[model samples]
Target: MAVVNIRRDVEDQFYRYRMPLLQTKIEGRGNGIKTVVPNMSDIARALSRPPTYPTKFFGFELGAQTQVDDKNDRYIVNGAHQADALRKLLDDFITKFVLCGSCKNPETDLKIMKDGMIIRDCKACGKRSDVDMRHKLTTFITKNPPPKKAKGSKGAGKAAGQSVEADGEGVASDEEDDDEMAKQIAKEAKDTPIAKTGKDADENVEWSVDTSEAAVRERAAQALSGSMQASLVLTPGDDEEEGEDENSPYSIFNQWLLANRPGGDEGRDDLASAEIYKKAQELGIEKKYKAVQVLLQALLTENAPAEVPKYGAVIAKMTTSEKHQKAALGAIERLAGITYPSLVPNGVPKILMALYQLDVLEEEVVQTWGKHVSKKYVDKETSKKVRKAAAPFLTWLEEADDDDEEEDLDDL
Candidate 1:
């Protein structure tokens, strides 16, 4: 029956977000022992996540099987776990899957995109954050998405401005208020001479327009002399300008990434990977591989080597194919060689290693990138310089591959 702050780290006594303390009851004996979370539904309700999610997370963390009895409101995990231990594990679940990456608020909803990516849509900050797709629990969540709320429910009625009284009387909603205001306006308008007899009264008033040729010429002369006429004049580069505007989504996303860089705020990291993905969705570029390229160029700065790992989850979710991997490499090329030329000789290797470690760039893709210098991302000379800078890392990857191949031969 005891309650605790949903985010245990936020020890503010007046914190609004609170959940029931996790209760574990162990059943059976020896190998048949299982840990049961009696108040998991209560905890999950407070967290706004399904009960099975945390239960499955416990199973993954403890290397045990989990069972869910939705009808009985029961969740079981094989192997006996203490309340404190399970509570700690639940905190891990909250950190990874519950808290928003931007504001650390727990008022977030887990949304599974059509691409099978799970993102936390934070209601507090209105930022969408990506979950670490590499986690095993993501697979389970994708398979079993949260149930959709029924339409036209009480909550929907309230949202739509429908109010109900305790005595079953219906109050005037926003629509009714607007209708009354409109009727009052019409009645007031009828008192005036303009609305006294509708169109018949208006015809009694005389109105005329000067559409003579001399008058038209005078109007044209005035318009031509005005500053507004400049906008009407078309130039040879109008098509190109219009095209650039058409591609403004990528530019807009890039500007957002630049403005909201991680560590921009004091004592907080603003790595809004899910927010970036959400922006891509809004721009209709979530499925485009090129969007990943924009993310790389916009996010990583001079300290790209240190920053790449922080956005690993973001890159992993966006880069799902070899083309995306290559696009990511192109962004890196532009970053080290063109954007920050000081990173040419030394920082490039570390950046490559970071991306490799995060599994954002595959071995073969890196090798292929290092083998040739194309003018696709940067000028040929800059491309060559970037490739030259990446040689040491490329050599290391080749050596590692050769060792792997040698091990295969020895086994054969």
Candidate 2:
């Protein structure tokens, strides 16, 4: 079987992540037709995910029903999907679930928290990234979690950071071959007479570090500069001060919103927005485009469509250019598509309309945003869905522009 990089987008031939090429076979006739993935288990094992995940993802993407028989190792999706089509869809699945958000490495483990949130813990970068819970497959994964690995088991050992040697074909070499090779090497070592030179004797001796106070002080004096020594000395409450600065400005702002519960009380909205703006200024991130995204995400609630106008003053203050407006739109994409997906397919139009009415987003920017769907803030699928929800509002804007042109002609 031919293998490809798990992240097929990567053209590097030597990429460590590899999986078998997806193979799809059409079965049955007419309405009963189905696509069967014979080697899904093998591919899923390579990805460190359950075989049912990609299978279900295919169903969701293609608008088809899927069936998984774990005992028989059969995964099927209704409808005759071609191999290339399934392969393309599989890439999207890998992007949304397999790849680490921070490092883009596929070496991650999906962990479900007690709060019912799913996160991917990357083994390579040691970053924990939240999985977009809005995707339909997340509910299935939550209900039918991946099987836990048993302690000291071969699979567990492999999963727990053990490196397995693979052959040219990208398959793990047989354990029997390793055992035989080890035994042969041991026999040859025993048969040969041992020669111990001075260097060899030295290699056999263990090394230890000197830890006496005098030795430590001497080493510190030689290595540490005055500034370095002064920096190492911390006074009381220094840890708390350092911890506050350790968090990103956006993260700190989010925590502040949670603690203050802004936008909950009437007539205090402007005061809250002003305080938020002051906080942004104090953090020195007031001019950053990302601050707009964080602001919208932190301030907007599930009823974002209605609340957008309420916070219009703050939005106008933060978004001074097209780039900032785009960031604000990206925030809406994340909010509707990932954070509050339940409001999608209806809430987006109202939200966009509110922004347009408040002049927070320009007509040109809105038109450009509706025309292109990118995976900058959300997955491509979610991006497309969010844009689709905004289609009606976009159409209305276009029609209004055309009507204005006709009115100008009549005036002439």
Candidate 3:
């Protein structure tokens, strides 16, 4: 991965090192002649040149800024385009966040690549589009940041050891209880007090077990009588039922909606999935920013299939989700309200969350920025080559429309 810091490290340097260069050299800081120089070489030329549009210089043509009435128009149009691009690079590097390509959406699933080009698919549309490197230029300088790790710590290994200890305790259920039934039963009764009278602790009595030879024989005979002569009883394993809808009432809901998220649409009734609605609510989707987004996707409307992620109770059951049963009740709240009116607000948050999930500022990121990079950053020889690299991502957006079936994160 290319080394880059999305928030601080790169931003700190861009302001200190790169920005000063632009202020003192290109903008002139009130010291001298204003002109457009093509490349860094032409930057030193200092010859007077024409004024030009930002996008026009790179051959893409984004648009224009306020015009300087006093300066010569010719000087405004030349190498100024490249200088402006360099400035944008610094600004983007210093940015706190970057948005998705199509919608300029900051909250996304992740960056995706199609045809060997990196693009960001919208969390809302599921349609892939080119990444907008223009917003934070340093993001481009270090396109893929180095993976971060902590010093003197083994995160995964440490967690595994704790898990193994827990597993050992859990395995007790599988081990055979070899102790004689009478003695074993006596130990359980003596150790674990039972509430026979319900309220007063003093009302409970200590269990009395007789280990006398006659008593042991009596208990042994009863146990043997209860034992099967040729035992063949089968108990279903819970692990076998996992990921299967065979015995679960909510399993159908899991299959139809919650599990198809992230990869693609699963053709389910997302709105009707009452169980998932409850999951989002109990997880505090109505309160936290990111949780709100995750919840909204679970309750999406018309354009459903375009964006959804798989979800599992174990995975989704974070601190954000406490009221799983409550959230589920809310999912079908609206339908219930139509009949009883009280159920209206039960899952109304789910609908509102889904609504806020909509995004719109994305398409313009590429068309405007793509041109500037070519003229300013790309060498004349290579500018032609790099411009086409953004094509695959942009082309996909121009062709695809959203569908209606969506999935929740449980599927993953």
Q: What is the TM-score of each candidate against the true structure?
A: 0.41, 0.40, 0.20
Candidate 2 collision pairs: none
Candidate 3 stretches with Cα past 4 Å from truth are 1-24, 27-98, 107-115, 121-412
Per-residue CA lDDT of model 1 for 165-213, tens digit only, reads 4312322221122334333433433332222111123355455659999
Q: Which candidate is the best by TM-score?
A: 1
Q: Whole-model lDDT, candidate 3?
A: 0.29
lDDT of 2 by residue, 1-412 (tens): 9999999888999776799999988999999999999989888888878888999999999999999998798899999999999999999999888888988978677889999999987654457899999999999999988655432122211222123232112222210123443333334333222122101122443556589999878654532232122212211110011121225565666555534544332324433567777887776557656667767775666677767877777788989888789878888887777666645665777788788888898999988777665665666668667876676676678778899999999999
lDDT of 1: 0.68
> lDDT of all the models against the reference?
0.68, 0.68, 0.29
Cα TM-score of candidate 1: 0.41
Instruction: Give the per-residue lDDT digits (tens) of candidate 3, residues 88-207.
Output: 543342232233454343323223343444454343323456544453322332444312222111211121112334434433432223235323333333333222221113245443
